[model samples]
Target: MTDTTTQKGDQMTDAPLLTDRATRLPAGSPDPAEDRSASTGLSVHGLRKTLGGRDVVAGIDLDVAPGELVSLLGPSGCGKTTTLRMVAGFLTADAGVVTMGDRDVTTLGPERRPSAMVFQNYALWPHMTVAQNVAFPLRTRRVPKAQTAERVRAALELVGLTHHATSKPTAISGGEQQRVALARAVVQEPDVLLLDEPLSNLDAKLRVGVRDEIRRIQQRLGITTVIVTHDQDEALSISDRIAVMHDGRIEQIATPAALYARPATLFVAGFIGSASTVAGRFLTGTPATVGADDTVLVRPEQVTLCEDSPLRATVARVLARGHFAEVVLAADDAELRAYVTGPPPAVGSETGVRLGEVLVYRDGLLAEVVR
Candidate 1:
């Protein structure tokens, strides 16, 4: 079940050639032509894992273009971290192949692979200074003393920690420690960088700062980066593309805007952003009629409230957000939420409800309609 090379035959085929020259396909077969091209910076093929007789990662495939920052996003135990670890060479896959550029490193150990990883705990040695920590990788590779110092200094500077080069991990801030971990990883100039929830330990105020810092550094280095995180905001804010995982399978992989606007699955629609589901049925190909069985997903921003719209609803509650007020409305056994930028509407007041860009789903699948 271990695939170690990329097969060149039939580029349009979804079947992947394993090390044993066997074709492995995922459940609910997806068209091979539909998968992203392998000209990608990183390609994962038929990744599968089992723990205690339970499939943890079931036949996952992904492609990350060169210099593309892709995020593996999902709730806890959704195999995001497990997939990251398999790519980093920390865990062996029960079935699959991992490729970086033109190299197949599926069986390669972490130290031997051309990739670096930043752990969630920062993994900084308390006794070592920032410079020494960053220099550890170069020293392991038997790099010249002068070159090691130069690379360490350059990495520290890249992360804006030049002033704290001699500082201990305890003396620096949490964000700074995270940077040190990043500096250490970048000093190696790895072909790919795997980040496992690197910002989860920071405070909310500091999270934004570190998030921006990481994105800036990644872009500056032009390194192929894959971040594993469960935070929707974190993935949406920085990733070029996001892979939404559910129960060890990728529900959808698309840009943030596409994922928010046209989700491929019901799980992705509910997981990636704030949404309210209302029962509805498709009146036509493009228009849907509210019903009791079908589920219609409406984003808060997609619902509009006006004084004279046709549909009337009673406001059940209003919660004020910074720039907008979230008003919950009940109409015909359907509960809808809307984001109003203006003043909050009075509770229990009758208001007109208008559907804005409604996305209809039936049987937990996206329904295509021609407008």
Candidate 2:
């Protein structure tokens, strides 16, 4: 299935982003009835959506606390964006409730909900100045000229794009343009913030910088935020918690540490990080609880290489990975990958391998964590 969220230019790769009818910038104005003082926590219950006769988002329940940043992470077509859009009021849920703070906004349009979204494509109008772009949403609401200008100035300053306030979208760097998009969203001061693949367009170096900047700004504002991302590293680095989705349902929701240390299901184990699955009998530790029906997950960090150990393996492949080498070893008919620092053994060399702490799964569910 084609991804409905991710996109490049006008062509979409994932879910389509919401935009103004006349321009590519975001739509919606602040609703007069929205309670600004209400709880900012975001909650969704029994959300469901079907597209092309197939379930795109199947029964998703999520809660994002006020001032918390949670990421909806999964591969494309897994419905992370679909779920986000439903919560954002862009896509209506088949059966569910989307509540922000104390408001039940399931029937409200995007404009009426107290939420703001940052588009993945950074949909700033090419003809508009950065300040104008940031102030566009405020203008939609007929905000006073003085307040709009003040908000625009403050937004640019917050994103550190004050000097580029007068520049057109075509003139600024991609990273700067992305900041402009974020600034536009931040200026709204909405209770809930939604971002659709906010950093998918940036290069590696800029991604880290902007990601940290976003976290800083979100923390400063204390807004409830949800970010949809396919990048595990991006989610792990910024999110207070991550909801790992697969097949239109969330398989697990936990902190970065908990998700990495103990994934709830078989899909989560392979999705959150790298791992090698081996039969329980091949595992060197915890023989009492491990059996033929058990499968052991060996993370790269858990693979130990010591010359004096009794376990044996043949070096298969050594891959350079900048800070460390990913050494693939052939052991007991399974390939175990280890992250080795400094010099690594050559191919075809016999070496000692030992399993450290590992997760044991049975019937595709996390059965035990053998430490």
Candidate 3:
């Protein structure tokens, strides 16, 4: 792929001790004006895409502030990838206007846009050394060898892979390869950086570490970014805001805390965190989206478990979570879960469950919020 294209696969060498350093463009030969791309806001208005006669990406509108990292989060087949492709100019939108800063880029191809991408699969050339792979983009653009060398060294250093600059892609570890792909993308210093499930292939422990590194690098550089992922934890941890997509359109877009505290729809509430549902009425008054008979939902953290209550429930199950235990209680054909610390009640033991700050919903839309 050339500088114009977004990004592709890659791999890296085993890096037992990776260094985390301040990330910025390195000294190089390119003109100072063109080397550092200015941060810019991205806007997509009436974006639509249809695949196989189905509306994969329905009409959608989004605006991302300069240097903000927004995530397109949803389950598989929610059109997140399609929307990303449209934004990257890889897949032409059926209908919509895509603008970066003030320039309308709806008709531009991937090569013409000032953006970079990192794919899930580290697509690296097996024959080329890590340094060479990172330098390929500069080479394609006819950059001077001396400048390319300096830039590649800085890029590798930024990703903590400077020691493996000469190692072949096939010889590196998977995590190392991922860093190499990231180095390649960041070396260009594009205005926008797009990542698609960048950490899905790593182990749980490694995933956490890599995600932290990504967040650090993104913050230090302040490049406007959009990441696509299904992992709730990943999106919540790194994004400035998250856009929850469902059935091709954006369900809700808000900060992590706001999204979790007050979801706009039941789908968002259920999708973001674990919530137990029961038929009940809202003493807080019926909201615009709710009806007379509302469905109340409470998160496990909000549900308290005690050995006292007039209406008792039987402890049905208990799941040990490292720091706390999730206890499932059954009462009158209804089930609720509570997060309990210390010692949880034994199975079949009778206990009382009290809900705090409930969320009311009617017809799958949020009706009321206690807090």
Candidate 4:
């Protein structure tokens, strides 16, 4: 995608391009122009919210560039929606500042902010045609008829829904309705797009397709986006960065690969993917020792079987898939599961297993044990 920017007073035409390869500044790279412009597109500082005398969003500090996709990922009721609402000006933050470019919108109403939101339910007007739905925002802004039609057509085409312009919301599939909603938001050409579980209503197969489409559209438009989702895979698949929330607090924020490979906390490690935590002790040299209460995390792929290995474990169960099998083992009162390529060992078989790559954490702190 390509962006053409025209600097004017308060109304600048900054068109963002979305493609497979979007250009980004390298980490910690400095740009004098960006510093002068305060080009950080979205900033949430010290955001706090409460509901029924309980703190929903304790505090959150986040930054998104002009064309970045960030996801707030966590289980249900972890305050992801509250934070998104705060950003979109749907809810006022008790103590914080929400800034888009240089404007502080913490106290602004939803309609006053230069942003759009796509709800989980699609929230399209059943009585309106796709074109009308896409043009709703432009109409609200009192845009001219010809201009509204042109922008609506462009937005619909961007979302691959140009052909459905005449279809009502009830006549289209769930995914198409969602595309209409997205097109509506895009027609406004807001500075940011806030998505609240936008893909949750679609079926499993459609969810995958729609998510890819959303990512493509977001990148193409170069709009800063923040998505709230409970599905970890969904967030990891589409987001440039993920902010994991737990207990109304932001736990960790990092790139998808970094968050998966080197999780900052035990909660993040367990929440991001499937992992097995085994009791073990860090030995001074050569090999680590197995013990109780000293948990070591290992991905299923980081386990291998060998007859000559020293660890003695009995195969308790075998769950076989097409390409790989999960072998559950009982070793010295500790239960662990290992992923092995090929056929699995039979139940009740005594097997020798070797640690492929173990991440040893003692007292919740990562330690440099030799093994």
Best by TM-score: 2
Across 269-342, the per-residue lDDT of candidate 3 in tens digits comes to 87897888876643334333444477878888888876575557899999999899999989776778899999
| TM-score per candidate | 0.82, 0.85, 0.84, 0.82
Per-model lDDT: 0.77, 0.81, 0.78, 0.75
Each prediction's RMSD to truth: 10.7, 8.9, 6.0, 6.7
Tens digits of per-residue lDDT, candidate 4, 1-371, equal 11222122112123332221112111121331352221338999999999999899999999988889999999888898889888988787898899987868777777666678987678898889999998886666555565556667777877778889998999998878887887787676666889999887678987888789788877766778899999999999999999999878889999999998888777888889888877664222335554445668877776677889777889999987768888988877767788878678899999887766766666775553323
179-220: candidate 2 lDDT, tens digit per residue: 899888877777788999988877898788889978886786
- What stretches of model 2 exceed 4 Å from their correct place? 1-34, 170-176, 284-286
What candidate 3 gets wrong by more than 4 Å, as runs, is 1-38, 281-293
lDDT at residue 16 of model 4 (Cα atoms): 34
Candidate 1's residue-wise lDDT over 1-371, tens digit each?
22211233224233211111122121111432332222338899999999888899999999988778999999999888788889989899999999977768898888766678998778899999999999887666654565567667777876778999999999999888988898888776665789988888778977788789778866765668899899999999999999999999999999999999899888999998899887664222344443446677888887889879877899999998888889999987778899888788899999997776777787888874222
How well does candidate 1 match the true structure in TM-score terms? 0.82
Worst 10 residues of 1 by lDDT: 17-26
Q: Which scores greater on TM-score, model 1 or model 2? A: 2
What is the total number of backbone clashes in candidate 2? 7
Clashes of each: 0, 7, 14, 2
Residue 268 displacement (Å), model 4 = 0.8
Kindly indicate the candidate among 1 and 3 with the higher TM-score. Answer: 3
